[model samples]
Target: MKWLLQLVLTLSVTFCFTTAQNPEAAGRASSWIGGAEHEGALRALKWLEEAQDLGDGGGGWGSDAPRALLALQLSNCSWIPNAGMKAELAATKLELQIALLLWRHHEPPISPGRLAQYTLALGAMCKDPRDFHGHDLISLLLRHEPESDFEFAFVTLAVCNSGSHARKRHIRRLLDVTGDTDKHSADTLAMVVLALRCVAQEHRHRDLLRFVAPPALALAALQQADGSFGNLHTTALAMQALEGAGAIAWDRGAAMNLVLSSQAPDGSFGDTFTTTEVVLALQSRGLAQVSQCKCNKPRLPPSDTELGNFTFS
Candidate 1:
């Protein structure tokens, strides 16, 4: 039976590799940060830089999560030596810093900024950032803007090492922030649950727990039996929520085991951006595990020219 289960997982992974379509930005970013080929990681970063929000210097408009995600990915690539890689990383860092500054100091309802975006992006850069930043970036995030699901969840992860007071403040702020927003689409709702669950785990809040229960249960009920989620990023975030909300007991060993067994051989994930986000989330959890999956596809040599070489920028 054990061998049979391994066979099934192997076959399922093989089929996914044979059929993957457009490279998912999230998955690729995760793999790169986890130490995949430098060129492949660069390509993913390039995609993210190109996709930046030109409208705002920070990267994009309201809650530009993708651009934020990509910038952080570029930041993680800082260890590389290639000129193109270095340049791209530098650009993303500046863009993300600018965005973070905007979120902290900019007016209006403090939407997720370069810092928040960079938070997840940075998660992709390496294992995690628990030891990376010194100043309370989460406090910076709260002071500047209204809390949302994304912000709450991110701040909780960011403040893992922070003292108790700040954790409560962030969690309270998250609950307060999402209470008023009308953005209850399935995805947004999932984001809200994600935030609440994480915060709740660190510092239990009855109100937040009450608020998150229905959605959290709904999301867990939605998980497929094969462990393949309906949506990749959503599933990943939902996992965070479940773990946070105490739905799944915080067993790092068990969780890591489940994740290892579920990962695709190509080092990518099961759903969209599967590779990128799975790595990011796992790293954020402080798992030092590296990806065992390798691409069977031919490796591309790094191009010496900049991305804009073919077209006028």
Candidate 2:
């Protein structure tokens, strides 16, 4: 009897350890996305074990590195008991990623669009934007100016993070894009709405919504038979934007299901960068929800006084 009891105890411990290591896999069938995938994010994160130079003077090709860390952070690997990352290994990996990004500095070809994306990831993890390895990432973004629809959208997110508002020119540009039914894709239109929703005042907010409503509705109509608005990327952005805009109610079940289907068995969405983008999109948040930023808060400094002071002429 004594030997049997000891054997049982050992087996129990082994089972528990295995479960902890890959807990997300067990829950995969039930939801499109959830906290369980934080493990996958962590697992995928291992891909960036070594950060070398990004050949385009871009410092590192693994731009998704910061995002992988944020996925783990937002999922509450710590503070949420029974969560994974309790092992020393998980914490070490996180620290390593932070060090990797911060130490590397912002290299060239890091456009405002790219920098804003980085800022969101860093801010999501509670890291400082102003002090990123001696780079004021926010200030750097200002220098690039907005040309692409994506840049306007990201800058809007950056503004929300810092408690700022949209400028007249940017608002105009975004509005112009939103008006063209045939030009921008669902993702670009979603991005436009995302920016407008974050910064517009009461009346303007309503008008912005009114302007976006037609496009937003049209985008929703584009939902494929599989429930995706377009491809994995467009679908992800559209889901977040439509949900955030209050233009239409979302069937999260359907949306999540679509996203989950695209993920490969290895916890990647086809490749490294897509995996990161999907991970972020799965988190289902707009950058403007600043209060959700538990870490260093990615927005600009808290003074309305500082909102537009750094813009290019």
Candidate 3:
């Protein structure tokens, strides 16, 4: 209990937030353009917090526990568990989640992609995947063979966040099997760009980063005229990559519109999973950009996109 909630306030208050210089950067972006849209974002966040498994963090896998954890990290959602949920969430809730994941990992085995994503959720909140309970996230991923473009992207991001060198070989294997061409989906391209950027930062492999430019271009080309990658789930992830890299100028309006439009009157997305992702994507718009998801790492070098400039180690 004390172990978990102690860091809640510190973590909640420290996340980055920044306003877009131009509110008009995109048409509907104007909603989030004003920082969480005040009422709307909070409504969405409130819905997410309520969706938590109050007594234990094992509500569901998709966005129930880990995904919601990530969403809370990305947005300024109120992490103060409700009077009842707070005490519960701050105590055995985390432990319950760890135990469940470990149990699953041993039996059927958590999918490589889900493991990578779970690692990300933990790392985003400043938790260590190296020693979560008795499991090592990197060790888990090392044994996995990624089956999709998204899996590669998630694994790359997980490694970057943990700063683990042992998994580099595995990541390279995934990359070698993947393509950075137009054939990839926007979601896939975005993940590739993000994973490559993480590689450049963690390993200083600028050579790998150079290959990211094509996928970035491919992602830009995939955008619908409306400013979303066709749906809130994909668009939210794609926007994170584009905004984080500061590459491939995007239709801010479209991106913003997608987030704002996806929100229901209840202040939530269609469900717990999409709501979690949607909130993070919209929330990021108003937050100061970070150099990388690695908690502490050198910035990325200037991208060819010429939108946002950063430096990498």
Candidate 4:
């Protein structure tokens, strides 16, 4: 069974490379975001700001500090008007501190997903992932053996973003997983696309480009008639993945339309999590943007304004 899967993937990759060589067959992918999409993203950003937890020692939205911080960084919320900019930067700093705290003291072993999230968040904040508060987040991520394709993808992104070389075996694992299943959810496939793209960005891994296209093509195939790969959340992530992978085979305009249409009057897609992702996708930002982020350190709030003994299990 394993051998058959490998053979199938080998042939599929070969075919993808062959197709990619044809200019007409591999038509340029359309841009996913436009002026209207940018407007919608701003609205979603407003909604995220409104939904943030501003209680004492609170600067994050929801339980996922790393994700929230990454989302805000990607949105470049600091560019908002004067007071709004200050508040956004403060919130971002607090969120960063919260994420660091969680990383330092989370008991019962942090999962690869959470660690990867932290690593990406740190990168987005322009912090050193290799020496974050005495923790080498990149080393920690590399030490884990991802148990699923999701973990593999997350780990790959984190490792690559931290200016660390992802293990060749990790790339092989991603390719194998992408070939092993057609039943992968849009979220999983999208993540795979981003991860593979990260690997392809390095000159050393240029040879791995052939393996990158199959998963992207598979993700493109999952697009629904309404331009979504699934719901609003999955659609948002899928858009990012396709764009990041440079696989413009999907319907960019329709996908953006669906995303914009799903917005509530409050300028949100639904919840905080969904809103964050939708904002990132609408802005055409992905995990890869973390490495490119040029951030200014926001002035820390008073010592009394700390996270207040918050603990992560």
Candidate 5:
């Protein structure tokens, strides 16, 4: 009877652990749209789609392909008018741009941030970052000595998302950096939490949770009376990071209220970049889940008038 009880207890623990780790089980649907917050997210999605530059030799928004792609993927806006074709075309152009950049610089094809961004963007687009134009972007990102804490955190996220092993040294460095509360800003701490969370989820390393705790705490501490971490972009990032780390103590409701309050009449949070981050945060999407987003609904074709006048610029 004692042995049977222990077996049942162990199974219960296992089920709880699995459920906590699984995003779907945790009620984090990739493309959930209905509530006020979700409606705001949809508005931001439309703003981003319309903001895409469809002019000659242009297929990106805000001159940043990876960020734009990440935002689009998070929203799963393929069913929104002509967003599907726009995303595909933008992704292709971004891929070609990456290839050209690699061709030009053999010594070090791209900066760590740029390479990380590209890896993330490709992953979101369902493209393999490892074999992009015969260049191994993940390996290249690992080789660089990241110039800043932000760069290091970005690289770690990219590596983890690409299904590649994050180096222990990099993880250790990030842990060390995150411990110094005086030096890092809210954005940096938020990024560190996100990167560590990605590594923890991918490797199932429960040990990393302790290391992730300090940064997550610091990020929560940065929350102001209005629930913003100084600004819209950082607040949005913090919301996603804290949630991703499972830092359940933070006041998510207040933070979300602050975010929702900032949406413009056009559904954007100021610029393309800010709107992108806000949309992701509003949806509870972490970088790791960006590539996992899938739209199961049958795509509706855009009207001829919509396609013919798609150019925003």
Candidate 6:
């Protein structure tokens, strides 16, 4: 009886561990894109193909989604060119329908440049978007001066989300091609570093991780002892990098402790974006919520003053 019980327990533990790591459990269907067999990729591919449109590139409508889907299919190990080609047409049709719907809702057409970029990037996955030749156009659009840093973050996500090593490599090349890092604004550097770290994690690229550490560390040093940072978004980016590097000294509780001490009485974090961030940081390190801190009130809400400053644009 004891021997039989042991076997059952061992199997149970094994099953639980496997289930916990099941790639299917991730929120995004594409989360396991490269990690899964071609059959699984096909399911996601079919869904996106059925949902995309080829015509409406304005205001988020267009071939981009389908392009991403088709690219994932091509990247899958199970794809055969003939069958994949057939599926690609259906996907493009789906995207075009979606674009039409979007056009109906638009007050004015989206910018031509934006439309071209979205389509071309999508097209690179399979057929090219009309007029735009390749992902290069998308990269160019992402390079717009005002908010290139933030824009690139999304573009990297688009390519990386496709789960193609080639796409990831292309994104890396885009980063390398940008030689203007010397003129980057503080916000720009933070966004770029955020994208770099995100791509690194997606591909388990250790070299990229190392490359992003210096700027992350510099940002970390900029944090006051109180855990408040100069810029809320940049601070979030820095913390994300530190967490990824395993260099935040979280076990010692230095960073978490500093954040806790700085949280205001109202449960609202400091005037900047520090409150929720500090709470989340503490949680990541296995600490309780700030409201549950033994020294504080039972509950508190983040203040409007703090919230307003960081309100989503």
Best by TM-score: 5
Listed in order, each prediction's TM-score against the native is 0.40, 0.63, 0.70, 0.74, 0.78, 0.37
Quote the positional error of residue 216 for candidate 1 in Å: 2.6
When 1 and 3 are scored with TM-score, the better candidate is: 3
lDDT of each: 0.42, 0.54, 0.59, 0.66, 0.70, 0.39
Q: Candidate 3: lDDT of 161?
A: 63
lDDT, candidate 5, 111-185, per-residue tens:
788888888877766667877645678878878878789888988988877777676677777878666866899
Quote the positional error of residue 297 for candidate 5 in Å: 22
Q: What is the full ranking by lDDT, best candidate first?
A: 5, 4, 3, 2, 1, 6
Candidate 4 colliding pairs: none
Instruction: List ranges where model 3 is wrong by over 4 Å.
Output: 1-40, 53-63, 76-91, 104-106, 166-180, 285-313
Off by over 4 Å in 4: 1-32, 53-60, 77-106, 295-313
User: Distance from true position, residue 2, model 4, in Å?
Assistant: 50
Q: Tell me, what's the RMSD of every candidate?
A: 19.0, 12.3, 10.3, 18.0, 18.1, 21.2
Q: For candidate 4, lDDT tens digit of each residue in 1-313? A: 3533554455455444433431211111223357888778767766665565454433446465556667766666333222243334443454344344454554677778877877787676676777754557677788888787777887888887777776656766787766864867778888887877776674245656666677788888889899989888888888888775664578988998888889999898877778878877877456766666555433222132222332211
Candidate 2 overall lDDT versus native: 0.54
lDDT of 3: 0.59
Query: By TM-score, is 1 or 2 better?
Result: 2
Alpha-carbon runs more than 4 Å astray in model 5: 1-30, 53-62, 77-84, 106-109, 294-313
Superposed by TM-score, candidate 1 places the C-alpha of residue 150 at a distance from the truth, in angstroms, of 4.0
Q: State the lDDT at 272 in candidate 2.
A: 53
Query: Which pairs of residues have clashing backbones in candidate 3?
Result: 17-287, 17-288, 18-286, 18-287, 18-288, 26-253, 27-253, 44-267, 227-254, 299-311
Local distance difference test, candidate 4: 0.66
